[model samples]
Target: MTARTFQATNPATGQPLAPAFPVTTPQEMEALVAAARGAARAFAASTPTQRADFLNAAAAAIEARADAFVEAAMAEAGLPEPRLRGEVGRTANQLRLFAGVAADGSWVDARIDHADPARKPPKPDVRSLRVPLGPVAVFGASNFPLAFSVAGGDTASALAAGCPVVVKAHPAHPATSKLAAEAIRAAAQQCGLPAGVFGIVYEDGHELGVQLVQHPDIHAVGFTGSRAGGLALVAAAQAREVPIPVYAEMSSVNPSVFTAAALEANGAALAKGLAASISGSGGQLCTQPGLLFVPVGEAGDAFLNDVAAKLDATPACTLLTGGILNAFQKGAAGHLKAAGVQPLTQGAKPDSGAQPQLLSVPIAQFTPELADEVFGPLSVAVRYDRLEEVTPLLAGLEGQLTATLHATDAELDGLADLLHVMGTRAGRLVLNGFPTGVEVGHAMVHGGPFPATSDGGASTSVGSRAITRFARLRAYQDFPDRALPPELQEANPYGIWRLVDGERTR
Candidate 1:
């Protein structure tokens, strides 16, 4: 029997969106993976110029249909037009960036170590460059329907790296995913790429994820979601007969520390800054500052008051799903009632959306249990009296995407311990700013250790470095000059810079 089809619901109005999506059968999913494997060899062998053109085509397709894409995303995600439009722009820009990456030809990371024929022990000529790691399975995220969905960074980077992609469309925004998926498919066709260069499977069931991970053709996986979900995928990938790396962006509270000088210099402004971070997109951001560090004193007390006022004025955030809304409400209530956590502001009971909540907890009572991310527009203020306590508190933190510091010039010299501690805990460290906005540039790091990501040290899921995850270094030893990949050839056909015998050459 055919599997059931599902419809999407608008989080803002509890209304259903049109055009249901069917859950593909196990056999159908196998076909999708098989098709991707079939296309992988050709896609991986496609020249940098051809791959670059493919990305440009996809970006143009999304831009051409920006309205339809934005409309579907907004309706399903309940995000403001400005946010969705900005996301579309980011998505398009990143695609274009990867197109440039393919065009520039530097992502290959080529190196050549010439042979030393007259040595006591002869050294063989060796040349190497990054090669695509076959087909990859990507899981779209709920919070970012456009940028982290069908044609998001994972898909864009994988395609740029010459790996075929098979995305698991997040159920919360199936229509949006479908729209993005169609754009990608059309672009692939327009670029004369082989079939299954890009594909997406419907159905958010655990079994579907399991089937995809277990599939022998899938070389790797990319995911963005809750710790539980990411962990589940990691486990599934490990259980496979031949394990594959799962680059999963999971939980992060994105702790923000307010230095004593910062708290004293502009406590009110710092409070407002904290509000701004949690205010966006109903605070569903993975980088949301779930915990804020404040020094004990009148400044901390006043800052708490400022936070209460800020939250009271902030509107309710429409969550992506009813289940998320329910979970947010329960988490808020349970934490507020927890001992030593003093409630500062409780916006409203959970219903259609989440009301912002701010609570205060002293350092004496702060524990690993209390630092868990609330996953909504709620922020917690953890009070610390002594500077020594800061490192201990941060040391207890799980792997994080970002850890922010609101510091003044006067405080910088005195923050060594805090600095040392934070560097180990998060991927991106921010100063006098919020972590909500992640730039799509080469310098950005959107991954962290352990719970923040499955294997943060190995790869990133954003920016140009993201392409490296879907590729591996290929070494050609004692091979003919003509047999070497174009990137590693003697002539440097692409004219891009590479390391030759430990020295950079073009």
Candidate 2:
């Protein structure tokens, strides 16, 4: 089929975001894959230092074009300037972080086992090294245009691991994706990398996403989106004869439980924080706390009242897309009308946009299915009679990226057993703070259980650990010096940490 044109409409103003662009035709798609596969061969052969330099150049390009991307993203996504600017910083920071990891040369996990000539029989010398997984298909996320879209974490990490990338740009922020892609393309040219080392595909339909994932030459897939979408892609890849791993960060509730002591101590303040977390970015984060557990009493009602009041005052703003807005409204209405549920407060509907809202349901009626993330500025407060009531309820959680607790040291100690149990349900456990500000550091774990991510141990785009996901280990058995990869050779040129004979050292 001939490719159809796709236009990005501004979420804030309901106007055309920019000029529409035609989707890549199947013929063009084939050529794109061919070029990416060719580039993968060259990129995969580059030294770690060389790849690091290219990544540094890409980060520089992003910094140079930051203003343009921010404007485009703000217009299309209805995100305020402050949030957009921060996201841009995070995006650039991610690229630079990957650059440092690549330059360090330790992500390769070099391991060497010297010859064991005196063994029964003969134990030959063995060495192991990590290598890139070749061309990767990166699916851009709707919410994070810069950090998870064109020049997003998947693209940055894949490049850091010396793998070529073919990105399927999200339609929600097409203009922003295009601008970031331009910067990356310019960086590739300046760095003397192959043209197809970074390819961008603008597709409004799911066919291109399917094609990109199912492409025989693509070695792996990286995705950040909904549970349904991520799972569908995984199934498609598995249907292939040579199944490739799809690292998809999908749905999460990011449940937060307030101990009775915390709730009774500072229910009002906690309610305010919850309001902002639920309403920020129109509640568009995967880590947004959807299920809030509080003790049922006058205190619970007081906390809910404060949250309702804050939400009532929150100004209604446009959602990222009309489709999202529709879904949000439908969901908000559904929860409000659901049995044993009540609306605490509703924001004044902006003359032009949807408003923020808070809804609550009794524990008996708030089933696990109702806890599905609504993807808008809405929250469901579930009241419990005691802390014991929370354990069984939380035990039903499928998977999550974070579980937050607001409690004093003594209270946390009392609930230590519960915290330990909840730890298994999430990748990160937080105390007193909302799970919105995801730090980009060595210790951060952004991916969690089955629904949070296909691989719970997978790192988000933020940390140095993300570099490992794109590389695979290969063991060398009694091979000649020439057969050994340069990274695993006895003479180590790129000085970085290694596990020599399974002992960690530099």
Candidate 3:
């Protein structure tokens, strides 16, 4: 039987791109999983330096082919050249960041305790360290084809943690994913790693994704997409005989609050910034501020008017797919019909692209549907009589990736309770700024509670700590020092950081 094939569509032109990709067959999916499982032990046994070399090599390979990646992403994603180019660099940096983590060898978090012979109940020598969780399955995201897709953070962190990775190429940008996979395979080959150390499967539907998650050999899964998609993968993983962890980054409205004092101080600037943040990238960002809380008064009204003016001037940009545009239109229309919701500004509607929209509603009339993510250049401003009223409303919101507060220094001093509530509701809190830009670093928290991520905000899909999701802790009690992993050995052959007798040491 002939396998069905699919091609990428240029969202800007509504035309199909060349070189259709065939969906992975059931047999092929089984083989890919088997290969990854077969290579797991060898890959896990590899030295941290070896994995680091592979990661660095992969980053370099991607840099060498950066232009090609940006071009393909622009056509398939409808993103501008500069943004796509920056994404290419950001993707490479993510790989290199994990490379540094691998080379350091300290991320394993080794710990040791010496035997105490003097005690009646002698304490035996005990040591522990993190080890790879074997093969991982990754799902590329539609919005971030490079940074969150094949060879993206999830793949980088998993491989850095000494786990083999098999990625399901995102259907939106198969060509770009293929290019990234090629670079990673080349890096694996160059580093003398197994052929199964990295693999990618092409598919346009969810069947292969479900199969990949359910594959017995896949020890963990990494995903970044919608709430429905993340939950689906989470459910599938749980249904397995031995369920694995799914680190899925899903939906977030990323609410922002503006105090009256702050708005009075810089209403126009805040308005401009909010407008840019909302419409940027056609509002596809996970951290896009979908909801805003503004005090009902002259200042708030002026701020909303300025924001509407800015959005009205902003041009309509093509969304990632026709389906996304349609959904955005439907969502916007739904908001307009909701009780007390009024359209603040509506940008010129392009035949194929999304029209930027800003809607306003009173806090009392804010429906749950209004709080839901519309997934395009659309946002809602909820009016409140006083700042205190916003606390209860914010408490009612679902877990968010970020919660931002725009307030003056004096105002912030009085907002302790509000800030505390924001902390509980979101993984990250932004003061006097927007939430669209997520910094990738050691201290960054990209994951959030509940629907924002599947792990109840326990894990992050970005930064150095992301490697921990693909690893498990193991303890050795009274084992020969020579038999222990280098990171956990008495001699500390890796020369990495460790906790010795409850004290941090080398």
Candidate 4:
């Protein structure tokens, strides 16, 4: 009933799942953001207990209706029941994590630096605390509808940090977004919070998203999508007069390096694992292992052959949307025909739109340009002749969300230097495990540098780190005890984490 109610169409069947709603007009978008801004002002000023209560209520509400949420998301996105169900659990867990974090209030990290009055010279005291950064614009991703859409990590973390959200629903899953938005709105109302604490905008085109990010009132932007799309929004935000920080997770070729020793030890088993990873989620995850670097030898060749054959045999499922399917086909074909690239596995040309394939080339042939992600169920195998030949090429790898090193104890010990360098190059370093299973926990850093994300060491899309994006620091200089804010008061009413004179204490 908002100005826009975008329709969701099935990618495989080409049928309308729901009626389309009008795109939000510029004025309507502004009004929605204004409401969120007002809500943010009050929400940020609320006690940590109140904020935590609201977040817990929202999580409980979502969990209670988990089945309906999963079904709606599956209907719109074409994901199978199992994946959707797990993603729904992830979504609720994220909300619950943020709830615990907000209640604890330790993320703010209040600090107080006292003056050296005892010394010959008198110095001024300094006290600081973190404050919410007004309203945020969140652009949902197509791949993980529940975990990245309306009731996703972006909204959860922003709310935990006491910032309001305006979610630009992904066109691929509008119905699911709408349903999730309703649940969040209901929770806000139940908590007696202001209306429009979280706003949902339904728009199929990019124009509205551009407007939302460029809006002067929007303090920051959170996005997860393709490199092209995420970059456009980042550019728009930077172009603003008062530039806002755009935390965008663009692209990553989560390259998996298989040591010669590991291949020699268990080539066949490793090949099967690689096949499953490349084909999982139709190879749609940002952390999907797209590239496999294997040492050139009889065992390596045999392993790659097995992987290629298995990929060809696997049946392709429907992609998230028609646009994604088209892009996948175009990118797969282009990458396959590129210089030095060779087809490893080409899925059977099915009667429907199921295009799943794998391609490979030699290390010398795989250039930095070829390392670019194709965004589908496509994998590239790079054959290395020697360990020395692998290092230089590995060093040239761009910053990635994750880089996996497949090795045994002997192989890992031999590749210690490589592991050390890889830790710096990627936000996450996986050892002998598929990179697809991203666990939501405190230690997880689901973002990376450069094209993987705009900010280095800051997670834009996943885990508790996402909450940091919604806050700014505030200092209280020489104020009366009564005038000091409750969060930064000497009495410690909130009883959260704090740093007193350069020391962390409860």
Q: Global lDDT of each model?
A: 0.87, 0.83, 0.91, 0.82
Tell me the TM-score of model 2: 0.95
Residue 167's lDDT within candidate 3 is 98
| Model 3: per-residue Cα lDDT at residue 279 | 93
Candidate 1, residue 287: the lDDT equals: 90
User: Best to worst by lDDT, what's the order?
Assistant: 3, 1, 2, 4
Q: What is the per-residue lDDT of model 2 for residues 1-506, given as tens digits with 9 covering 90 to 100?
A: 55579888888778885588888887787888899888987898888788888888888888888889888888888899899889888888888888888888888888888888999888788888789998899999988888888898889989999888989999888888888888889888988999989888888879988988889988899999888899999999999889998999998888888777787888878988898998888788888887888778887788888888887888885788888888777766666667887767755222223676766777778776677877777777887877888888888888899999888787766787779868889889999989987888777888888888987645664578777788898898898877677777767767777787778877
Model 3 weakest 10-residue run by lDDT: 346-355
Pick the lDDT winner: 3
How do all models score by TM-score?
0.97, 0.95, 0.98, 0.95
Q: How many residue pairs clash (N, CA or C atoms closer than 3 angstroms) in each of the candidate models, in the order given? A: 0, 0, 0, 1
lDDT of 4 by residue, 304-372 (tens): 889888887788768888888887777776676678888767562222245557677888778776788
Candidate 4 differs from the real structure by a C-alpha RMSD in angstroms, to one decimal, of 2.1
lDDT of 1: 0.87
Cα lDDT for residue 404, candidate 1: 90
The residue-by-residue lDDT of candidate 3 on 16-73, one tens digit each, is: 9988998889888888888898899999999878999999999999999998998889
Worst 10 residues of 4 by lDDT: 346-355
lDDT of 1 by residue, 220-331 (tens): 9989998899899989999988999999999989988887778788887778878888878889899998998888888888887887889889888888888888889877
